[model samples]
Target: MPVSGTTKNTAYTIVASSLLAVCLAYIGWTWLMSSGNPVLTDVVLKLPLGENGFIYGVKDDRGGATVPFSYRYYVYRELTSNEQIASELKTAGPFLVTRDPAIKVDIQGSTINVSTNQEVYEYHSSTLFRHTNSNHYTPVTINLCKHSSDQPTK
Candidate 1:
């Protein structure tokens, strides 16, 4: 007698194969779904977080602590005297930087170099400044709170 090669359980094999396909699909979908969210450091790096929203500065070497609004606040003014600017820098490091961090980014060593984005200030005790390297009438110390304006009355 001779034997035939056809499987008797072809239907069962097909069903099993189908189930395995579905399971594999589900596993792949879950893997894709689970791989989305990242850690806090990634979010911080991708987005521009304001001073308050961020707990620490990743840019700074010391893992800089968040300073109060008061410390970050600055005011700047110009004067004809370079000596006055020097004196303020001696007393305040950050205070000097905040008021006017540097020249207009493009106007370094140029005569037209003045603070580019001029927001009105009310004047406070603290101010920052830079010298024109040419002009004496440059701003000396501008009070950070100098531009302070009272709330609009109803």
Candidate 2:
């Protein structure tokens, strides 16, 4: 027996439809995974060592405002030898209390920049004034939080 033209056409249609459906599903899954996390692609942190200490803030590349996320300050002493150097320090709070609520800071490269709109706020850590050594430094990490009202001004 020979197959009819109608049957052949129906088989081709079914294969084509199945392939199209699979492609659409794959595209949808990719979109879902990417849209789950809002990431800050470009961030700049400016930390100018002022009379008080270091001023911290972040420039929002997305053209919104940056708010203080979280920070940890520590005090360390230098332990160095002819070949190797280490530090013995006291670790302080990854403090939840906002040091300056009105001020925001972001990490850009190696420096943390403060917002210019407000007066330069001081980062108060007891060890901040203790030493000016390379081994004695502060490490701060920040995350850019998007607000509901943060829409592009333009």
Winning model by lDDT = 2
Q: What's model 2's lDDT at 73? A: 25
Q: Give the alpha carbon lDDT tens digit for every residue of 1-154 in model 2.
A: 9999999999999999999999999999989865322222221222444322333222212223564332222222222331111112112222122323344555364344333232222343222322345444555333323233355896
Error of 1 at 150 (Å): 52
- Mind giving the per-residue lDDT tens digits that candidate 1 earns over 1-154? 5444445377678889999999999999999876332111211111111211111111111123553111122222332233443333233333212222122321122111123232422223332243334333232232222222355778
Clashes of 1: 27
Number of the predicted model whose TM-score against the real structure is largest: 2
For residue 84, model 2's alpha carbon misses the true position, in angstroms, by 38
lDDT of 2: 0.37
Name the weakest run of 10 consecutive residues (lDDT summed) in model 2: 82-91
